[model samples]
Target: MAVTLKAEKREDLNKSVTKQIRESGYVPSVVYGKDKESKTISVNSIELVKTVRDEGINAIMSLDIEGEQPVNVMLYDYQKDPLRDELLHADFYMVNMAEEMDVEVPLHLEGEAQGAKDGGVLQQPLYQLQVRSKPADIPEAITVDVTKLEIGDTITVADLPEAAEYEFLDTEDTTIATVVPPDTVSETDEASDEDAEPELVGADGKDEE
Candidate 1:
């Protein structure tokens, strides 16, 4: 289900107006979609943060703009204050529920790999996956089980189970996770050994240059 978020139309585009909006605990935002005119708006900063925290980023939203009908939307992008770590602005993309769209979904590994338990290193090359699905059918995340993975074993996109709701857009050979033998020597250790000064010794057991 889509979460409903109330928003107010923004009229003033001046810097002062934007500063005031931020000071008032609201985030300046814009809503746009294909064939639809873009609208400038603002939403309560606290409410927006809470919604995203509770619902995953891929969660669909019902944007209730004042004086207009609600529209199905998704949070496309956002900006934040680098120093203050505060939300500065946001962008909402109005979505057509019936049309399929491509989105990146987070990938999660489930369970401990047998290879890792045996002292092998487990590596995840791809942490997210490109998926195509309708707005309502979009998944929160794609999970892969690695419990059975042994050393040198890899899980690729093709190994994933087929799903009717969404399709993976990545190439079949794209590796998601893998296990490999642990390195005997780290790069730092190797560099240190190479840079070490050699000890001098004589045939008679006396130190000599």
Candidate 2:
């Protein structure tokens, strides 16, 4: 389900004005579509945070603008306070529900790998997958089960299950996760091997002076 948020048109576009808006407890934002001009607006900070937390970045949202019909949008970009982690600003991309759009959706790895349980290290190189799908059909996330994976085993983009509504944009060969054997030698062991001296002996099998 698409989350709904209320917004009011904003006239101020300066940095100072935005800063003041943030101080007043509203998140300044912009909405733009390929067919329409961008418009600035503001939403309640508390409401915006809740909506994002509940819907995530992949889901479509309905923005109810004052005096206008609600528009469908997706979270496109955002900024945060470096020290406070507060949301500074956000940009919502107006989307056509019937048209396909490309987006990056998070990949969730589920279940413990058998190799990892047996002392092999598990690594995940890709945390998200790029895909193209209609706004209404976008998935919140993709799950990859690693329970059966063994040491040296890998799961790639090609291994993902087929979703009829989605067209994966990532190359099929991209690796998603893997398990590998643990190291057998320590730095101390390597140094000892390098420093050990060979035994010096005479031709008659006696130790040389």
Candidate 3:
């Protein structure tokens, strides 16, 4: 869900002044991105938190700043007050809805794995992969079926049900998740001896314990 916010100008950029601003119940934030200059504005802390908590990190927000046209942006990062547990600051990234957006969507696996019932371990190597699509076409998450996965059966990135219009940012050969025997040997052996071991141990003797 997209959100909208109204911001006010702040003349003070000093720490002491910004601290005073926070104490009064306002959150100072900035919107940063590729082409546009960074702009600083203050918003209602309670309202800002409510919008973010209700929506999501990827939610596009229409920011209404004085003397400037309303700009739509996505929340990229934020800083919080650990002690007070309050919103300290936030950063919004400018999003171009018309262009393809690369995002990582959540992964949800359904049903009990047949292999898992017979002492097979279901390992989800990668829960999410970076995908490219327009904002309106963005999917909340990808669903994977584990019901038919039997021992020794492997699932690769290509097995995922990808929308025709979207492009997966990951390589086609990338492994997503898999169900295998409890022994955990075939994949482990191939990954370790052939490719993974050398990369995992650059010089350190960090073999499997």
Candidate 4:
């Protein structure tokens, strides 16, 4: 599904100009492509948030710039205020639907890890995977099943479900999720004495007598 947004060209290119635009409830943005000339634009803050919430960043967008024809684009990047969660700026990458592109798709874990039930710790070391596929064919997310995972077991990139349309960009050995024993003090920790002096060696390569 295509997410569409309405925007108007922004002529002023200054910090004060962008600040004023935000005060007026708009997000300053830039759209650029391999062949298309870069253009400065702005979109209504409320509408932009709604579009992102519904379609996500991977979805193809139909940017309807005022006084120009609509163009296809992808949400490349954006910034937000850390304290207030206000949208600051955005950059849209124009793309050709037929061309393949590399992107990171979120990994969604499903089911409970058997290790967790046995008092083991379940860890998700990686939250997303990089994949190459056509912009239009990009998936919303890749789901992983963890019901069979046991303690000390791990799921690697190579274990992911086969997707003929996607080429995973990560090394096959990279672990996405794993289960391990709960943290506990080791024997070495219990035996160590903080007051014990460290061993010293003589300059002649022998232990001190």
> Which prediction has more favorable TM-score, 1 or 4?
1
lDDT by residue for model 2 over 1-209, one digit each (tens)? 67888998999788888888889989889999997999999888888888878887776889999999999998898877766767788899999988999999999999999999999888888999998999988888889999999998999999888989998999999999998777632554688899999966764432211
Best model per TM-score = 1
Encode model 4's per-residue lDDT on 45-79: one tens digit a residue.
99988887777668898999999999999889888
lDDT (Cα, tens digit) per residue for candidate 3, span 51-150: 8677655567888788878877877777776656887887777778788788887677888889899889888888887878886566667778888888
Question: Candidate 1 regions off by >4 Å?
Answer: 184-209
Per-model TM-score on C-alpha atoms: 0.87, 0.85, 0.74, 0.85
Worst 10 residues of 4 by lDDT: 200-209
lDDT of 3 at 19: 82
Whole-model lDDT, candidate 1? 0.92
- Choose 3 or 4, whichever is better by lDDT: 4
- The 0-to-1 C-alpha lDDT of every candidate, in the order given, reads 0.92, 0.87, 0.77, 0.86
